[model samples]
Target: MSQLATRPPLILTLRMDSQSQEFFNAFRKTYFPPERNYLDAHLTLFHHLNDNDQTLATVKSIAQPAFTLKTTGMKFLGAGVAFAIESKELHNIRKELAIQLHEQLIPQDKQGYRPHITIQNKVSPEAAKQLLNELQSTFQPITITARGLDLWQYLGGPWKHHAYHALGPAPG
Candidate 1:
């Protein structure tokens, strides 16, 4: 069987509104190393979930309304940089999912949720620090809309879109 035929781990992320997505993507494209930038900007909720029908069903069961979150600050990630986000609603949603997929949660996923959208990674620490400083110099908190949950199949470095369940609507 081909490698892809076997189930791969799943990734869950929040889908942002178009404007917010574009804003993040722009920064990601401009700052991230071109060769290593496989996916667009994302706020990962669950880093890894079992790739199975049960997991899919649980994800499909989530019903959340569109909500807003704010980017409060820039986080320097040693070798990368991210925009820190704050939202009670986002936390609640992930907590609920964590409960449902408790056994399947990996250590990283089980760790405390610190929501952030990484725009630059795989660079030197010095570079990351410089970018962090540049961004923070004129940083203004941005309010962005979270529109839905998006499920993806992890394909090594790159990912393949699996499904998207819009907030404020029954799972279709």
Candidate 2:
């Protein structure tokens, strides 16, 4: 079998609303190192899932409802900065997935799951901190609707689009 066929495509992320997308997109473009900027801004859900039917099955079973993630604040990530997010429901879904994929979960995936959208990465600490300060100064409470679950194949740095499942419907 070919190497590509044997390797399970990994990397799943959460899809967000359009407004939040525009905001994060602008920030990422302006702050994130130009060289490392490849894909659009996104919030990750599960990272590094073993490529298999089981993985899809587990995702299909998630009952987590669509919700909004309030942008808590900006976090300094040593070499990057991210907009912290808080979503208990989303976390629970990820937790459930972890349990289902426990045996085959990779080391990194085994660690605690933190939901955040990185606006800047692979930059100097000074650069990160400066941007954090700038963001904090003008930061306002932004609610991004966690619309759906998106699946992707990790292509080293950039991710290739794969599949998406939107939540059924928001309670009336």
- Model 2 residue 83 lDDT score: 92
Estimate the TM-score of every prediction: 0.94, 0.93
Write the residue-wise lDDT of candidate 2 on 65-92 in tens digits. 6887898989999999999999887888
Give the 10-residue window scoring lowest on summed lDDT in candidate 2: 1-10
Across 38-147, the per-residue lDDT of candidate 1 in tens digits comes to 89999999998888877888888987878899999999999999999999999999999999999999999999999999999999999999999999998999999888
lDDT score of residue 44 within candidate 2 = 79
Cα lDDT, model 2, residue 86 = 91
Best by TM-score: 1
Best by lDDT: 1
